[model samples]
Target: MKNVVLRASSMTQSGKYLLRSIQNESMPKIDLLIRECLQNSLDAAVSRNKGEKVFVDIQVGSCETKKINALFDGLTKELNKRFTSVTVDYISLRDSNTVGLTGPLKEEDIKEEGNYGNLRKLVYDFGQPQVEENSGGSWGIGKTVCYRIGIGIVIYYSKIKLAGNKFESRLAAMLIEDETSPKSLLRSAGLKNGNTSKGIAWWGNEDINGSSYPITDEDEIAAILKDLQIQAYTADETGTTIIIPYIDQQALEINANPYGTLQGKLKDYIGLAVQRWYFPRLYNKEYEFGAYLEFTINGYKIRGTKIRPYFQEMQKLYNITTKAILNDNQNVEKPSDIYIAAIDMNSTFSDGRTAGFVAYKKYNEAELSMLPPNNEPQPYTLLLRDDDDDDTGNMPVIAYCRQAGMVINYEINSAWTHGLPKLTEGEFLLGFFQPNGKKRLRKPDGMSGIEITLDEYLRSTERADHSNWEDKEVYGKKQRIIEKIQKNLPKKIAATYEESAEERKAKADQSLQRNLGKAFLPPSGFGKAAPVRPKTPGKPPATPVFKTHNLSFKLEDMSFSDNGSVCVPFSMTVKNGLDNIHLYLKAHTSQQEIDPGTWEKDIGSNFPAVVLYENLELYLGKVAYTSVEPVYSSKHVCYGIHISQLDSCYNAKGKITLQGKLYFKHNDPTISIRVVAEEGDR
Candidate 1:
């Protein structure tokens, strides 16, 4: 029978091909894989700590040549034991409903439908492949997904325990046959095991397809594992540890240029991933077992959990509690209230208080009877652990009632999905037994109970910031909650008549009359001509004012956007001897003077000469004004002056060029002055 079974297995190569596919297929993203593993670690710790929160701390740094390090600490030891070593040849980030071993590559099928990529080699590893019973990757294929990403091999699970005890540690690696192949890319540059002390433990090296062996340094190995200590959760007993000598190539690249890539990608979760996952380890001050778990990433402690003040505030605001039933019959009794702490998903990294809540009520002796059933004649429901209970060991971490029981399944991803693109489909409904608290919410078979979906009810709570949260549509029943919330918002400010189309047109018309130039407008463009201050009557100085010229303002072209904002253009010019000042419709005042130069005399509309400068854009602070104010400045003489603001004028004197239009009305019309000043005018 044994010979027949072996022969039958050898007859077909499908299993071999499948294993090869796992070793050579497109590797799952590295960071995402780490995130999943880290998430699992946190889940385990929090569960074991009696609902104590967890957190993830990440440290990024450089290592030996071509190496980058990601030190994960908080609650890291258990993760090490659970996943002592993670290879890249195979992995699956998403869960599934179907049976059979699903490939990580299979997940990409959800969008690509199998056209993505495939694995080739059967990358081997020694680590606990199953995160939980009946979970995918239980056969150890998941760790291989990391192997394909240039992580030459994994030499982890050597020796690590939670309580500093010994356990089964697996160490493994692969021999690369090709440089171009993603699955078997070698880390060593053709250096065999015998050539270096680091590879002394391995068997004699063999040269195959230019591939070589790379050994992990003992010091480097210890350093990384030490950093993971802060993330571990352990008792006075045993535990586990897993180590991968190298991270994925992409992760290394991201670490190389953190500012340009990795930092930006993990900006939100980088600080919290480790912390949230290993919350209990971070906050557990009661563990006196002397470092039950030690996790270090490059020798840095991944802090535990941070108690958010906002959540504390929310607890104060509402007396939170969950109401549940014991059985499926209408006569089933009701359970006590459960207080829940808020866990805000949308809040900023610094705002730990933005999350929703976890509810729990005080537990009692007879409460087990009142609690939802766990087996037949009942359904599995959310289990609320009593912190005050003494008889229930940590094993009660998972409550097992008679027939039906409760399960608190947190959907962290929902935080990312909700309000992104659009509002959640409906109001979050949270009901233990809402319509009637005493009615039995569990089913007879004890599968899924009739408990209310909390998400639907709680989501009904209105968003505080409509512009921020309700900027889009709310589907189905949620529309009513949105409408109800909308009523409470402050009314929009009333629009003013000055902002009306008619008023804007009148303003434009008025501006047109002013910018058309003296040739086009009448006395509006003509400014009073002041006598040029003559040089000392007799003595002739080195410089002299050979000529003086005066120019007038003019109007030009105008345009506006749909919003009614206007843009005007004009021109002006002035000539004195060889110096000729020509001002295009657009004149910058700040270039010629420190401040705005105004006309010494006022214009028709009580408006002062304007101060205009390039890049001096001010929509509300300073209105966009257009006028032709040209000035000519030369050594021998100065002439033709146009001043916008008083600050730009030298004793109310500046030469203006008689070239462009200057007819736009100065709304203030306060300080513009026209003066004739020449060189040597003293």
Candidate 2:
């Protein structure tokens, strides 16, 4: 049989635009490629069989361009014209023990339901709806990540068992590039005329009508696979293999250099990236419904036993959540080390079901030290940039996913952390949330409601990248459900660790009394009524100095700055004081005041930036005083503002008000202000 040639339909899409459309800013391109490809493979798990594990192999290597240059028709010309290279590095992802792209081989054969099947959806289609329920992909745009990671050329091969125990193999190739480029594959193939070419071309069996279809001849596929130096699937094997030629090796090695002595290879990064996003699925045996994912890179398997230690705590939390769902019990008791709190979406959204549960565990220095350490860097550190060696003051981290078990995101700070208590020194919090996929809800409609599963509700909140859940007004009243979930996450987590009401009130009272005594109370005999004495014969009785008993400082408003810092507007009133008043600003948690010096030392950053009041700025450990106005300076304990003597009689009847804005850096913890006032020298 003659080799297939490249073909492009009339008025198709530009490859460059398609690649850019699905670009994810939050994740690196290589990570995105791995995550999306793996997700698709999992979604295509064979439905006829149960208890079968899906096997995925990610192989990276280089091959001479001339060996397989003839397979892609005009691809060789474009490659030679664009890049100066003898060999092209490629990444091949193959999966078996699952269903391959099963669908119509031609576009006109699509069903009335607009079902393009896995083959068309992955290779030719864009933004198609997912046919299977509870599928991991919703946006239908994930496949573009493959094109973006390479030179916009990808080969597709799949082997599937047909009726009568017969086996069939499919092979095709696609090249997407900037059509505007003079050396574009579309132009070289003579498919471009002015703006007609979408910068996309495909290589396959060309029909009389010029439409391309996947080549079904096993001999042709084997010849091409042999030339490319990729292993061909056996006759009995079933699954898909995606080959991305001319991969940008440097793009895959972007953050690999940070890992000391790892040689910054693609395999090292690929292993960690797999564990970072897919740990929940790796070697998971508790849940029968969840797919068991097996991964390998360069023929070396990523063993679950070896990588489990790094994510043992999180994995345990995931298992607990999974077990709760499996047992049909949402109210799971908190264990000694972990707290499993059920997020009751029914309470807020009136859905009559729990959205999910958040599993939280605080690891102190001693607890973290007891865990086994791996010489290789932790996956979270490489992916999240969080240093695990420094166990103190690690911000409360939470990773959330859906029923698919692919982590949607790992967030250190977000709306889920708001109103949550701050972690103490030498401690950090880790949590994971998975929505109740089995539960169902009714989305609001005109005079009626559309029933949907909680998984679908949450999936709607995710964008194309599936990084974070956001509330879009298009979801209608369902948006309120998303909002409630975000608002309730911290509340539920706090409920698990918060102190009793009486204990809280007592603590609050102590903090209030301490701050009041230091900031409001005057010294002995300064504000008290003095005893009268007879005037001396040669001297007049001295005039009594009035004490300021009505000094008030209140926080008027607080907001977030553009850079995520905190801005506080405050008002201070002085009534009937002729003495200099020293004011101190402190960042206070529920328990006690945070010492600026101690905070800077522990947190690895300055406690907070200087508090600006008009033309004066107050920092830590420094004091600046104006002749007739207030003195401002940063102190070791707190920021200080010193005000000189004020007119006692003039401002006695009317309150003299001072208002200013206090600015704090973005990294500063959530805290209330503690203002202290003391009498200073005249």
Candidate 3:
């Protein structure tokens, strides 16, 4: 224990360092712990067919320190010593039906190039490389997590099942601190080995030189546990249980959740963190042993039926995931069990051409209302590889991954805005780009999951994204992966935002004003069968009223709108009650509506005394409207006789209102010289 350090000069520094190593963009330290722990269990299960049923249990206990006996005085190396008593908390993790830590008892037993047992893989080494394909953690740092749980005091007891009906038990303690002299090594634990290993301690009576090896003898194991008043391993079971003698007091205070009537304890929040991040691996068909989780702190417990309510609360995510898998990422499609999206992204060095469906899930606003408080939409873009358990809820709004399913970087949804259409507030997008695992079948979606796959990337972080979600830098040789994704994925998803023709029309012209009344002003009455401008031009611009042969007409007022509607006010008096009066409007240039012609003989018989054309009968008192709803004065219209009732029009160009044509409903609906409005007797 000379060069090596075990105990921290500061607990906060040690705790923070351990936390930072396991933390992810989307999860808290506790969540990262749960995910890493259960995933390790799953990887262990995959080692055997029957071990697939992985049920992991967690127990948190708070107890006051009992007088620790047998402490060796630094100078004399004698036992029969005591230490100060303090209230300590502990958490234990027990996984059933697992191949417990059964392997080399010491570093000497390990080989240069061969298989090792969990015991050595965990205790004897720090940062030991894992041999399993699906196993997690970077450099075996995860194994030390238990030791970092409290004031750095953790003991491991494993009951291993051997061949036939045999079983062996192993007990060891691991502690780390500042290096000390051989005679006075406070950071030391486990077998003394006469002067050999000082890190791991085993059960057995001390030998001549004060060194003790593991007590493999079954009777000895039982007698030792019985003597210490500790629980003995059951005869029929085999698994590993980790014990933390002292938990971090500051960690509890810092991570405790303040939400409900009862302030959530640190351990209770950790239990919730487990539920948030590990549910993906734990959810099952209820009866089956897919994955089991349990957490307890003090009097409170997150075990058995208690997890149901928490689990059920995440049902909204299932619905979203269901859409991605079965309905082609749309709610309208008939749901199918499988969904696939092919991705094809290629940088000069790396190629990402894989077919898979993008999976996305988030707690929507409606779902958040159902939960009591604190809990909100937990959005996670599930790419292939995500190694974390911290449920602190800091996540990349959009996660970018590679073919192996490892998320290289967790990115924010806004990061894509530079290359795509702008997104509105309250709108979120999460996509899971997964490569097909089975027969390399062609899929369009999963093809381009990775952007920059530089050969020299992350020599230290085990291909994990080291930067937090908000950190943005042009990565790789020349902004390779990030640039490539921005060049394509945004354009594709943006196309889905297009609107239909009917939808456009409904939104643009829902009001009557937009649907302007249509009127066609065709020509008539010419020597060439064209319009005839009658010789009825009387008064000049200075005169307000003009007299025709039969009646008096006055140009009251005229108005035109930028939106193509026109309004005109005209007054006509024919002495007695005027005959049928109607307003005709047509949309024309500043010029004319019809060509006029003179009265000709037989050759130009097409010219009539009057000609006929298409004209609309306007509703009384209504002119073109400025607003959606027409506002009119009842007193504005001539008595009894109707003038016009015009709301806003939808015509490309609103119809033009002609000079007031006063005409009685004769045999035809054309302008008649006799009924034309003329000046009154005044």
Candidate 4:
């Protein structure tokens, strides 16, 4: 058989670029692996029948060491050390429901664009540029992750549905062990060579024309796979399954990802990594930018079951995108909330990518509804990270993706952060940027924001993350886009937006004070003398409603009076003391004697306060003056609290209690006094 030893120079250069070169931190090596392989799969994916998402299976299984018997005559002596310690453990990542690798096995001698020669290119070439728009890996360095995963070795197997109803299968392997030493014998699985360097090992017989193809005989192929201790593709499957053998536990350990670790095992870590990286595609219910689903890691589906626990959090993020964060049209009906804008721009000044994209939804800290902490409290926070403070979830950088739904980068670097708007008052932002794949997506004419044609010029560094783009134009454009969003979205979101962390705390405290809760008071000790009636029974006792404030009250406000004798609006809370009783302030004096300063109600200038509590609303409670003349009082102040809207007092069994305050409008000074209780012991 003719030997096909690849040029040593080309091999060395590719190996250096992919494995030997330390471009960035090694912890993300696996992430790079996941990103690239999956990107390729999705690019070649097709709906099962008409409209269905693609399915991927990332499996971890083992084989017996004796099974892999591929050997060379003189090479065995030199390769013994290399092959001796290799565990039969392997990770078989396969993607089904896709258009199987359907292309010529080899590139034609004459160069052409649509050569359909993927199998040959993937098996033989390195750093080959992909002409497809939605294709990933601008530098093709991502494929080197396979070599990095193991001791520099990778295998490929594909099952293709050819013309008519026929099917075809092929297999290839790449080995990148350093060849600097004389004893080192690095070889790949390819054509069997009795002459020259052992290069290609064909699963099938060579054609009459000397062209190699996979062994079509299922029995032969199966036996060969079993012999080599390699995973086999399913007969009915019509896609690709990659086997990363000699699983490198040491490699994974040496990387030591302190942040994103999963159990200590590489296999376990892989599962978590998959969920973290590909969650968006799996949770794509909108079916707009991404259509990936049914992800399984080590046989566990990442959708509703294995990843079910994270769904609530993922949904919190997903809902923001599907339902806009700021879209508020009634008829044509925009999404619930979103800040839309054109993302397209110039390539001359920016990174050289053609600008185009649609639909960007902001998850500005508040919109995420309170993410969980990444540290530990049962469920993890978003992306399983509690960076920054380590107790709270970090605001993720906007996840930017190509049109094919393949994530290019998560904008997590300083370069990206420097360009983004600074979060104020604990306000951060996360926007999902979905660039249109060379399509012009127009915003609805009735929509409030401008059209979104985002120009995403990701002139990325070797890290594959566009973290270090110094292009003034690209940064300038992106900054301008963010500035515009900041200027517009808040105004619209202010209408129905969820309260920020600080606001939530204030509102909750306010509600707690105003709403009377069930009393949990300690049992009173038995007393020998039980008074039939206390002295001065008609007089209401003066007791502070809450420790925080002492409020002056009319005795009539405490009693169930049919006449309009009292109007008191106040918030009271109690702790430390268990006086589990509900009491009201009564007017100790007559209505005329208890007269308050009267002022004309003017809403625009100085209107009555609108005291809003969760359970009750004392419209006039916020006003400085208790009584306002007819023409002066705002409707709120005139109405006062409805019978249903009186302030309720509650106290917990603790050393904390709250008191109320009565403010005079003209002087604006508060009158501090204990609330007068009704006749009851309460």
CA lDDT of 631 in candidate 3? 15
The C-alpha local distance difference test score for the whole of candidate 3 amounts to 0.39
**lDDT by residue for model 1 (1-682), tens:** 0000101222322223323434322212343234233423332331233333333323332233212123221212322433333322211121111111112222223363332211111122232233332111223343433333344333222222323443222222332223333332221232222322121112111134222222224344445434432122233221222233344435544542333411223322233322222222333433221111223343445442223222122222122212111111222222334322222222112212221222322222222232223111101111111221111011111111100011112221232122212111111112111111122212224345344222322222212100012322322223222232222111110111025768768866665444322222122123443333455768532221223244433334444434222333343332222232222122213232211223222111111222223322212113343332434222111123333432232222354332222222232211222212222112
Runs with alpha carbons beyond 4 Å of true place in candidate 3: 1-29, 46-51, 67-87, 178-232, 256-263, 285-340, 346-352, 361-363, 369-396, 399-495, 498-682
Index of the highest-lDDT prediction: 2
lDDT for 513 in candidate 3 is: 28
Instruction: Give model 3's TM-score versus the native structure.
Output: 0.51
lDDT of 2 by residue, 474-506 (tens): 335435666777789888887778788698667
Please give the ranking of all candidate structures by TM-score, highest first, separated by commas. 2, 4, 3, 1
TM-score of each: 0.30, 0.70, 0.51, 0.56
The TM-score of candidate 1 is 0.30
Backbone clashes per model, in order? 152, 7, 69, 46
How large an RMSD does model 1 have? Answer: 21.7
lDDT of 4 at 61: 69
Better of 2 and 4 by lDDT: 2
> Over the stretch 1-682, how does candidate 3's per-residue lDDT look in tens digits?
0112232232222323533454444433444455556555655552343214665666665544442222111211221222244544566666666677777665555676555677766655555655543244435666554543554445667788777978789865554422233532343333233333333233233344443334466665565444333455687677776766556645654543322222346665666655544443444322122333323344355565445442443323332333333333334342243222333454323323432234333333333332234333223212212322111112324443222112334445355433433222122344444322221212244455434222112212342222222212323222333344444555555454557868755643432122221212232211121233444668333324444443444444332323212233455433233333332221122343321122122122111112111121222235532211211122111111233322232233433232332211111113221112212122
Taking every candidate in turn, the Cα RMSD to the unseen true structure, in Å, is 21.7, 10.3, 21.3, 16.2
